[model samples]
Target: MSSESTVLIFGGCGFVGFHLVRHFVKTSTFTSVAVVSRSAANHDNHVDGATYHSGDLTDHDSIEQLLLKIKPTIIIHAASPSPVTGTPNEYEHVTIQGTKNLLKIAKRSKDVRALIYISSSALAKGPEHVNLDENHPLANTDPKSSAYARTKALADLMVLEANNPFPFSEPSVKETSWEGHLLTASLRFPIVYGTHDPTTIPGCLSALQKGQIAFQLGSGKNLWDFCSIENVCAAHSLLVQALLNPKRSPGAAKVDGEAFNIHDGSPHLFWEFARTVWKFAGHRPKNDKVTSLPAWFVLALASFLEWGYWIVTLRTKRPYNLGRQQVEYACFTHTYSIAKAKERLEFTPKQDFEGGLKEAVTWSLKQDHWDEKLKHVTLTN
Candidate 1:
């Protein structure tokens, strides 16, 4: 990586991609930072130094035209249809086929040197598991898995499989192994949240504000891992650096062709996360005390709703909220090991968890001048 190196991010306007564009631009590492997204023309929060291009990943001509035009030295892909949308067709075409198209064109490009794909830990086996890692076989292929899981797992494997072979020996000395080689790697993230988070944090706060979160869904004991968006951004930057100088990286093998599981490392009780949002936002459940719903009962009812919805809609649309997956997630424990990331890329959460929560809440409050009402309140508890 040098001053002349150029980087392009797919879905650069997205929650993850735009932050990445901001990250690369702030570092000033790449002279040219370009963002390619389907909705580029409508995005207004454009970073000053970076350029935005309208492109579709699922279209070969779209991908071909962009790659030929940009000729990026480092390509970071953070694009995927959001899980909340639950649009299986978009998941199939954009995440699965779209990644296929990007790789086919990128691998043949003489100027491209590195490719990093953002993948999801949802592909990990669901329920009754702890510290799931890259070796977990991407066990999301279970019969109940959604189209999202299947597409992500398939695309995740494809990106890693495209890596160039590198000497796996540790380096007592540093070396440049990136020239003329289009190395690829993947980062699997779990439940990312932070300031400006359009999905998770805002959704929870909105539901809380509306007094929709009436009761606990499960035992409220399951430990869920969350990665701050800043930490995720930092991890991508470090992995990009590690891939550039892997031999010098304090690890046994080059980061090429490997996937890393990353999170904030401290898994909190599942309900505690939502409670923190309420706590910081100076709100509480409509009820004075939260009560638990029977996990098995909820799961069964969700199954019935999912089946009924699918039948009524002829499977064109999924449930807006209640589903088997949602119930199961509420009931089960989900955590992943970041040991590989720590060892290989020296990646650590840069944003402290407590502070990140406060920042997220404060930002949300500032949106409505809600902060002025509770300046004395803080996260002392």
Candidate 2:
């Protein structure tokens, strides 16, 4: 609300976190920004006016010290274990326990006014459905859900349940003098892709380069949802603004202890979108070069791979690139409705599919692994 309000972003050096930090520093009215990261190595990427604090989320004392020193008015929790890592223990430690620690510290802080959590749509249970919304049940009890999903669902519950208003019946030991409540909300993001993305874009490009993406798993017509990095950052900005100015926000009642799904508001056939990226990246999906496979066949293969990897890595933890969940994502339609976000947070995608794809391709081209020979490659269609 006030220009003097300080915002603290956890995982500030990460892909989404860095963009969020930049968004607040350069675009939003918030003048004071501090980023808490596991390492300050990316401090150079932070904007001129932003401050960086190095701290580990897993360490209670470390996070507490940082919170006490910064005394931030707003806190954005974006740090979590990488989805690609597929380490269950790591997800539990960083996502569940780390959030618990932050909540404990935040509850004690008199200055903290709002807390925004960055979550995932993987918490959706059952088969992929169209227009899934906030009322959809979380997949915490789903046996088939990924380790990341289960852990995140738990963390999401904890965050929403921790939202306590002022004049609380039970107050924290350090917050006796505080007058206001700790406002909290969560944003569940779908496949987020954009420049500096460490997951989606790079993984797809690497598979394409290696010729591993030689086939479409299903009809290539399954609709999927994606949220651009810019949109993700924009949603965070809107959430922060709403928390700061509740009466002015149109959907103020929906701001507290709420979770909203964020996407580009456009759904596309899975492989069609992939083909667009491939074409833009100087590659053509030829009929001969790329084969089409039945979804059942791919699912069978994925199951075999999952079992084989489990046996092979019995004593160790290794990320399996192909699994049942990956196959389900590729074969099913899973588009979420962002009506709540649009109404409540005034969230909108700043870039369309084509624009975001072009930006991603342009960014990818500048990477060191980009082949010069592929520069002039053109689409056959």
**Clashes (N, CA, C under 3 Å) per candidate:** 0, 0
| Steric clash pairs (candidate 2) | none
How far does residue 129 in candidate 1 sit from its true spot (Å)?
Answer: 3.2
lDDT to native, each model = 0.78, 0.79
TM-scores of all candidate predictions against the true structure: 0.89, 0.89
**Residue ranges of candidate 2 with Cα displaced over 4 Å:** 42-45, 167-180, 246-252, 285-290, 372-381
- The global Cα lDDT (0 to 1) of model 1 is 0.78
Among all windows of 10 consecutive residues in model 1, the one with the lowest summed lDDT is 170-179
Taking all chains together, the TM-score of candidate 2 against the true structure is 0.89
Model 2 weakest lDDT span, ten residues long: 167-176
Q: Per-residue CA lDDT of candidate 1, range 10-128, in tens?
A: 98887778778898899987789999988888985578899899999988987888888897877998889877656678888888889998888887776677799999888875545
Per-residue CA lDDT of model 2 for 300-342, tens digit only, reads: 9988877777678882354446777778888889899999888
